[model samples]
Target: MKKDNKLKLNLQAILTDLLIWIYILGCVSFLVNHWFEKIIQTNFVVIFGVAAGFISFILGLSIGRKIFLPTIKTEGKWYKTFWGWSVFLLLLITFIVGWNLVEVDLYKLFAKFQNAGGIMKGIFNPNMDIFMQCLAALAETIYLALLATAFAIPLAFFLSFFAARNLMPQTFLGNTVYIIVRTIATIFRSIEAIVWAIIFSVWVGIGPFAGMLALMIHSIASLTKLYSEQIENINPGPVEAIKATGANTIQTWIFAVVPQIISPFLAFTIYRWDINVRMATIVGFVGGGGIGLLLLQQQQMLRWQNVGIIIWMIAIVVWIMDMVSAKVRGKLQEM
Candidate 1:
């Protein structure tokens, strides 16, 4: 009973602090307008925002109470206290810096919002023919992702064993191989696929080929990480036993690690392919050529209904891919 009271008190204290912070934020903006000749009109928004803040505060308080029913037993509150204080301090510092750091008039923001409103609304009614065109492009995007992932999976498997410190020989020769593999993975992952796609599009000309190249590079990096982790985590006893029987490094790896992690590798590859398909669609916008090219063209042409169809079709494809990938991964894991 006493603990419950303490929780309620803590909640109240937290809410009170938030209210004080809100007022301080308003005042900070208020200062920018009246001081330093920088007229920041925060009044119109400040007034309404502050009012909404209070209303939200009351609603949030009620929700918090509702989450913990009367029958629920409370536990140690140290973690909660630590998290609450940490968050409060972080947010308080953020607000303090934000107020003095920048100032803007509410009216200008409102005007910009009003101006963009119509175009944003028009985005909903997309063009149907352009959308159908996007669907075809999206299929090409999926195909590129599939092909890239297929190429990367086996290649990554070979790279990861060399990369794994435990599996490789403890000589300069082995360490060099590890360094090379790691360096390649890091370089590939560091560059965004869209950037890769941009470069490839220039090299190959605008088409799915550029997108496939981008996906392949990205997949090599991502698959290397997943494969290396799986290789490093595999049971070492079988590897050691195989090595003792006069087996070569390749033979030992084939006998031990490959059998253990093949399922997981397949699972990871399937999941990555699904993710790549979705990313491939977006990369097309940068001239790599996929559904995104169609979507962008439609948007530029003011084909709202087509744009709507493109978005919906993309969503459906992504959803199906997710489901299919999950099921396939689950089966691979079971195997």
Candidate 2:
């Protein structure tokens, strides 16, 4: 029985090795034919290449089967079936197709570095003439994000209770309301804030207000999902205890659930605000009015000096916000 099982394994291994060798040989032959057909025009070169490749493949297979394959064993279920190899081949094909479709070229990327010195010179010697103007635009971006998040927090707080299944009454109407609220939130979240900005820019005729509205809408959807998940994960003990005390629904939430999730809710809200701040810079590209608008205009006009200043300003503001948010979240966690 042992001998029969070992023979079967050896046969399967040989078959797998033969398939891999055929695939590799085909790929190498195609490349060699395309690149060296003129350099080695003689039929002798083609025959010699094929002979060399076959010898190499045979040596590699012998070493792999005798020395390496026996030493390596995977006990996982994936290794026991063909599914793992199928998935790997699928990924390999996807990568090959995507590579050709994208026309990825490292040579082009390398060539662009030749012009980098001039850009760097302009960046280092930034134009200060429009300093105040750019600063005001930056300020407006921060204000817009803050205002949007402020408005979103309260609305999300209210909606999260409805969206959370644990908080719902378990009745048909309660389940229906949960599904509807969750679906709406998912739809809103699916559309990026930048797209929202473009739509609102058209609706409100562009400005900081348009950007604010866009941020607010996205923030509401995102925050509701976060808050609901947080509420759902809260300790159920307090909730049960509150119910046993004959506390009403709203009272139960206030006394039982709110205490546990408030810290995380604040943490998520702060993180969202940080994200909105970064997004606010981009929304301005669609005439949603902020530092990004100035940055875009400078870049289009080839005013690299001014563009450099804008970049630095954005980086500085983002760094500050990141620090502030990290500290706030740390404090919240402590509470």
Candidate 3:
């Protein structure tokens, strides 16, 4: 039986190695064909290339398994192992392909550096005339983020218990509800606030309201995930103790779960608010409203100095929000 088990393990390892070699051969063949087709231009060359690649891979794998692999195993250096080298080569190939696909040109950046001088100058010397206007816009941005966070908190707080694995009942109905809620949250979270902003902008006819809706939707999804994960990690002892008293599902959560997660929940909410404020500026670029719209206008009109002022205002507001959120989260952690 032990010999049979050893043979099974050896077969599995060989199968895995074969599959990996086939995958590598396929990728390399595709790349070689793509790059050389334009230059070589013949079926004979393509066929020969593939055949050569297959033979080379088989030979290398056999030789490596016999000699190189054992040498690397003795060396105890991961970088010298076949798998490590494979990963490094894969990353190198990906980088090379990606660089070509993107048409990266460092020369153009340096050549056009002088074109940005005027804009840079304007940014450095901000137009103070529009300071009040930008401040008002910045205020709108802050409030938009605040309202979104406030609205999402209660809904997320309610949904979290259902989404949490530990809190959900072990029955079929409870499992279904858990899955549905978690799937919906994941779908909503996967869609960025910017995309939601675009959709809402069209529906709501473009403004801070659209931005607010976008931020709120994203916040609800994000907070639900955070809140549920926190619930899952809570001390099971309190939960089991509460269940021992013949409490129902809801009571078990309220008495045992809520108390533990409140601090972390508050902290997560505050941190999310900070994120929303930064995102609000981006949402505005899509006409979701706030200082971003004003900044966009100035930029399009080449009013770099005005754009500079808006940028500074955004920077100041974001910095302040960051500091406040950090302090709030710190306090909550202490509690």
Q: Rate the local accuracy (lDDT) of all candidates.
A: 0.76, 0.82, 0.83
Residue ranges of candidate 3 with Cα displaced over 4 Å = 1-85
State the local distance difference test value for candidate 1. 0.76
- Taking every candidate in turn, the Cα RMSD to the unseen true structure, in Å, is 11.6, 9.6, 4.8
Off by over 4 Å in 1: 1-126
Q: Which scores greater on lDDT, model 1 or model 3?
A: 3
**What clash pairs does model 3 have?**
none
The TM-scores of all predictions, comma-separated, are 0.68, 0.76, 0.81
Once model 3 is optimally superposed onto the true structure by TM-score, how far is the C-alpha of residue 238 displaced, in angstroms? 1.5
Q: Write the per-residue lDDT of candidate 3 for residues 1-335, one digit (tens) a residue.
A: 97786666545544555544454544555567667853443454545544544454454433224333343233446476545565566577666666766778999888999899878988899999998899888888989999999999999999998999987889999899999999999999999999999999999988899999999999999999999999999999999999999999789888998999999999999999999999999999897899988988999999989988888889988999999999999999999
| Candidate 2 C-alpha lDDT tens digits along 219-286 | 99999999999999998999999999999989999999999999999999999999999999999998
lDDT of 1 by residue, 228-322 (tens): 98888988999889989999978988898899898998899889999898988888898867788887887798756667777888898999999
Best by TM-score: 3
